[model samples]
Target: MGTSEFMLAGLVPGIAQTLDVSLARAGYLTAAFAAGMVVGAPLMAALSRTWRRRTALRAFLVLFIAAHIAGGLTTSFAVLLATRVVAAVAYAGFLAVALTAAAGLVPPDRTGRALAVLLGGTTLACVAGIPGGALLDAAFGWRAAFWVVALLCLPAFAAVSRVADTPAGGVTDLRAELRELRHLAGALLLAALVNAATFGVFTYLAPVAAGVAPVPVVLAAFGFGCFAGITAAGRLADRWPGHVVAIGGSLLLTGWIVLALVPGALVFLVFTQGALSFAVGGTLITRILRQATGAPTMAGSYATAALNVGATAGPVLAGAMNPFRVAAALVAVALVSAVAGRSGRPAGPGRPSRSRRR
Candidate 1:
């Protein structure tokens, strides 16, 4: 699903040029996609409670495949935009069901691992699908890239059909889910703030890279660093989940400031941006889940919603900032993360302080 969306990133400049639209209009492609994610997360969660998991998964994939094909066939930008929303709806529904299904399939001890695998698919999608789509767009028309995505889903759909079916859990109790929300204020607020900072800086990553070093070398360095950071986050989360976020956010804060101030260290700048991506995508997801501790279902939905919200907001905030301003914003975010980390410390062996265990 992420790859499918990233595919649009490569296509947007071309699409805008082809359609003779403003960049802002072309930008709506992202908004439309994200809008779907925002609306879809909760809607899918609500819907999943009604359908059997396997049945819902199959239906959502089918719809996603159909939407992709529809998007490829459309010539009217409005129609294409609408089709993208359809694809988003399908994507959101599939994710909600997929995560729920994964949890059901695994032992409680392994839920984190299961979620990590699901998220890893998205990271790998960036590594492979986005670049591949860009190359396809370069060779053929950008429309061909959408067609490629439409074609790829056929096998994905077939494979999804093969997963063994499980019995549905109790009817999704929305009231219970609603009750969980009140207790999650700290986690939710922290997530929103973290995403805003990460997205703000990350949204401007390419420009930040170009400003610091030779663009080509910077890109390669960034990709390599992202791979390393993402690989490390899962293991780190297992031991010091909270600390992992603090460390990751701190790296991002420091890195973005360097990129903004140094102005000619592409390698280091790229390394930092890559770290932000890797940490935000990896540890941040885990952090959101951990915060949702006792409320997996609602947490899953809300986390997904927070991700969409961040993805939506980051670029807009970044776009609004001047270079130095962007760096300052990142530093502010880092500080907030550090403070949140201090307050969120879980009680562990030999760590009780005054007023605890009273």
Candidate 2:
């Protein structure tokens, strides 16, 4: 799902050419996907409240597959954009339910690690899925790429269908859940900040690297680094979650500072990009999920929404600035994370009738 959301991103030129539009116009597809996720997360979570986690996941996977198939068949750019929005809905829904299901399968202490494993697929998509989509686009046509994703979803659907028919714990009291999450509002802000920091630089990374290394090569390096960083962070999250976030954020901030000072240094560009990706990947997500105990779907939905909000906002805001000045956005990200870390009031297990006095 993550792969599908991003698959068309680097292929904007090809899509625009195929759809008979300008490159800038094709960029709207990316924005549309983010917008869908932001809107879909809570929508799906609330709507699917009565379904089992596995059931919700399976439904989302099927919808995702259908969306891609529709995308492949569409000639109109508007239709394609609409299909991508459906794909984003499925993507966000699948993620929210899958996280909830994964947590249910694990012991309390192991939930973070389990989520890491689940999300590893997203990072892996960066490695294999998006690149594979790009290759398919090059060899075949843009539509062929969508067909390939539709075909890939078949096995995932089969796997999802086999899970037990257990009920999703309960329906969300969205208002109450929102209230509980507000207690940790600082953390959600930090999550948004972290995503904003990464996307601010990442959205423009191809241009930055085009001046140094070839675009494909730098992107490949970035993908592998993402996989490596996430795997490492996942391994450490169960026992050392705080340390992982702190060290990762520091590295991310330091990398941005270097990039700001040394505009187009190839080595810094590659390494710092990796550092930023590492910081934003698996570790922080796991920690954030762990902080919310009741209403796993709601927590997941809220977190997903926060991330999409930042992801969408970051690029638009950064694009308005001189691209080089984007580094200042990362600086703000680092400071926000630092302040969030300091100001955080811990959320404890179970929903409280009245807010717990700390």
Candidate 3:
């Protein structure tokens, strides 16, 4: 799903040419997917509140696979765009359910590690999937990439079908869930701000690193950093969640500021910036989940919604502006929120205090 969301950027020229649409029009596919995710996360979580985790997972996977197949077979741009949105919605539901299920599988203290393991697949996708799709497109045309995604879903479907059914977590009342979500608003806002900073600069990485290094090399470095950062956060977050986020945010803020002042250092900065960005991001997600014990079923949706909101807004906010400068400013705000909002507080309206848990 990560590949499907990001691969479109590389294939936009081909898609535009084949569909006889302008590049600007073809770009809408990416935006459409982000919008779908933002809208679908909470909506699907609420709608599937009565379903077993296994059932929700299987159903969404089917939708995702079917959408990919339909997209691969379509020639009309409008049809293709519709398929992207459908696939994104399915992906959103699947991700939310998967995260909730993953957390449920672990002991409370190990939640961060479990979430990290699940998110590792997405980070790996950044390292390999985007480039792999580009290669597939180069060799067999853009449609081939979509077909490959559909084929990949088959094994996932088979694997998910084997898991024993488990009841969905949290209260079934939609109003209660919404009220829980409100308590989590501060963490969610910080998440959106952090991602906006990370992705805003990332959206224009090629131009940002114009003379410093080639695009593929820069991307590989950045992806590797993301993987490393998340791995480290998985181990550390359980012990010192606040410190992880704070230190990562500090590094991210510093990195972006340096990039703004010293554009020549982009080749090196990209790797460090990627590490810090995802380190902070991964920690923030774990924090939100840990704080959301009261709204376990809706926890994943809250996190997903926050991320998609940032992903959708970042590039738009950075448009025609100095991306590095914009990223630094955004990170500054996120850091302040993290501190002022008391992101590391042990309890909220629906949660048990650390002392109570003990």
Best by lDDT: 3
Global lDDT scores for all candidate models: 0.68, 0.73, 0.85
- Sort the predicted structures by lDDT, highest score first: 3, 2, 1
Candidate 1, residues 1-358, lDDT tens digits: the string is 7778767766888888887888889879888998998789768767676667778888888888788777777777898889889889888878876766775676654555666667666655655555677788789978888777777888877887887776545354777776777756555555565666545654555677665566546555555566666666656755666566666666666666665667665564666566565655566566556555445455566767766776777677778765435645744664675576557767678557524522
Best by TM-score: 3
- Residue 62 in candidate 1, Cα distance off native in Å: 1.5
Show model 3 residue runs off by greater than 4 Å.
343-358
Find the 10 residues in a row with the least total lDDT in model 3. Answer: 349-358
- lDDT value, candidate 3, whole model: 0.85
Residue pairs with backbone atoms closer than 3 Å in model 3 (clashes): none
Q: After superposition, how far is residue 219 of candidate 2 from its true place, in Å?
A: 1.1
Candidates sorted on TM-score, descending? 3, 2, 1
Candidate 2 residues 101-208, lDDT tens each?
A: 776787867876677677767766765656777788889877887888898889988888887767875665757766767655666677776767566666677887
Q: Which digits, one per residue and each the tens of the lDDT, describe model 3 over residues 167-187?
A: 995456667777887778988
TM-score of 2: 0.88
By the TM-score metric, which is better: model 2 or model 3? 3
